[model samples]
Each structure stands twice: as structure tokens, then as C-alpha cells.
Target: MAASGISFRVAQAVGVGGALWLSGNIAALSLISIPALVRSQTEDSVPTSILSRQWKYTFEAGKSQNPPIAVATATSFCYLAWSVRAGTQLGRLVPRNSIALYCIAAILTIGIVPFTIIAMTPTNSRLIAIAEQKRDAGGSVKPNDEPVEVLMKKWMFLNGIRSFLPLLAGATALVAVLG
Candidate 1:
């Protein structure tokens, strides 16, 4: 019984550690994206100057790289947390559905919104490149596709959602922890 208690406590620690690591990674992603978000928010259109062009490319490159890293962090964190819980006495004490709910909430409020923004942002080379590829494939130079206003609007809306999600998740996590 004593050994079981020790194991359970260790497992709980692992779960909490996973949560902490995930949270930290999310925070880091948010910080990394902040400048790009600001640039997107402030600029009316993609810039034309050399420096602005360089910055835009830099931002795009960063956006592409950040999402995969962030997703990996979230996946590893969730896997660790879930695995730890599965081994614990609390696994029996806490309803499985409740754990599922927590995981869903975590993924929704933490993993999805922010990552989606990074993935979809106009300055993200992947999105722009895809747009370009489609345009080139269609063999059109007309401004009919990916208008600046449309891209800006989409980026703004998604980034706004991404900006607010971390706050929501933090509050939810606090409630879960305190209650």
C-alpha cells in the first residue's frame, strides 16, 4: 500500500510536469509570434522595401518552423500526462471521461487556436507559397486570387483568436487546479 501511494504521487508529479511544460511551450510560441502579429496588425499590406521584405521573409520562415515545434511539444506533453495518469491510483479515482474532457479542453484551448494562426498567417511562407504555387499552376498574373485585403482580414481574425486563447486556457487551468 505504501509503495502504491509513492508510485501514485510520482505519477501525479509527472502529469503536472507535463502540463507545466506544455504551458511553457505555448507561452513561448505566443511570444515568438507577437512581433509578427503586431506587424500583421499594423501593416495594411505586404511591404515593398528591402528591409520590410527581409522582415516579412523572416517572419514567414519563423511561422512555418514554430507550429511543428509547438505541436510536438503539445503532443509530447499530452502523451506524458495521459500516460502518467494511466499508471496512477488517481486513474481509478478520476473518471476517464473527465480526463478526456480535460485533454479536449487542453487541446482546444491550448494546442489548436495558436497553432492554427501560425499555420494560416499570410506572412507564413507556407501559406503564401501555396497560394503562389496554385496561382502559378493556374498560370495567372491577375489580382483575382489572394487579394491583400482578404489575406489581411483572415490573418487578423485568426491571430485575434490565437491571442485570446491562452488567457482562456490559463483561467480554465487555474479553475481546475484550485477547485
Candidate 2:
């Protein structure tokens, strides 16, 4: 019935439901696998048997990373679908409230993107090398070295900006529909 234009609202509801269901499952898997990955990373300090077993499980489904990445993509789809539904629902049902919903959706979507990216990206040890270089060159290094946190905050700020464009596009579409 998806091919048929049964009703935009019905279709949207189905689509949003599917996205939410898939996202929930993916989020569960991510929550499960994340700790295992962390355990594997710290495996060296653990028993060899335990380390090997954790490492094997972590990589068993293909690569050590595929599952997480797949989950990431699924989550992204979830967010995109959620945004669509929010815009559509707001416009259709609460025309006056659409603006508020649009803004909220945009903020949430934008806020999540950077966190997702940072979670997925591997930490580059080379970044520390650069930091070290500056310190060795007699450059004044800050007493409290909080590089990772600093970078994460910056990345999140940029991600908010990154998310704004698509969200703004969605909001624009919503405004057009309302007018």
C-alpha cells in the first residue's frame, strides 16, 4: 500500500513507526556492544583467555566495527525519519505550534549528530603527537591538559551547526506548507 497514495498522514505514521522501531533496536544493540568494545580495548590488562574471548566476540560478526557502524546508519535514518514526521505532524495538526516543534526537532537533531560522529570516530593518537610537539618546542602548554574534552566540545558545537542546515531546510518546507 506504500506505493499507493492511501493518505499522507497514514503513510507518514507508518514510516515514523518503522523508523522508531528500528532505531530502538539499533540503540539497544549499540548499548550492548559498546561495553564489549571498551572491554576489548582494555583487554591487555585482563586475563589472556578473557581478552581473547572478548576480542573474538567483538570481531566475530565481520569486523570489530561493522555492527556499530550499521547501527549508526540505522540511527541516522531514524533521526531523519523522525524529523520528517515531526514537521508533517506539526504542520497538519497544530499549524500554530509547527514552528515550535520544528525548532525543537532541529535542536535535537543537531545536538545528536556531533555526539554520534564523535562516538563513531576513532581517536587519533597523532593528535597527542601534535600536542606533545608544541610542548617540546618550549611553547606554553596549559597546566591542565584536557584535550579530549576540549575537542569533543568543539566537535559538538560544529555538529550543531552541521545539523542546522538540514533542519532549517525542513523548517523552511514546513513554513511553506503552513503559508
Backbone collision count in every prediction? 0, 0
lDDT of 1 at 93: 54
Candidate 2: RMSD to truth: 11.5
lDDT of 1 at 81: 39
Candidate 2 lDDT, tens digit per residue, 1-179? 34323453443333334333433433433455534444554563443333334434432442343334333433443443343454454334445543444444334433434544564333323223323443434444434343433433343344334434334433443452344
Clashes of 2: 0
Give the Cα lDDT of each candidate.
0.47, 0.39
lDDT of 1: 0.47
TM-score of each: 0.45, 0.32
Task: Tell me how many residue pairs clash in candidate 1.
Answer: 0
Put down candidate 1 lDDT per residue, 1-179, tens digits, no spaces. Answer: 57755754454344344444544544443455444634663575433232234444544664575455445434533543364376565466555454554455356445554576556543454335534433344444334345443444455455555645434544443343333
List where candidate 1 sits over 4 angstroms from the true fold.
Answer: 1-55, 80-87, 92-98, 109-150, 165-167
Judged by whole-model lDDT over C-alpha atoms, candidate 2 comes out at 0.39
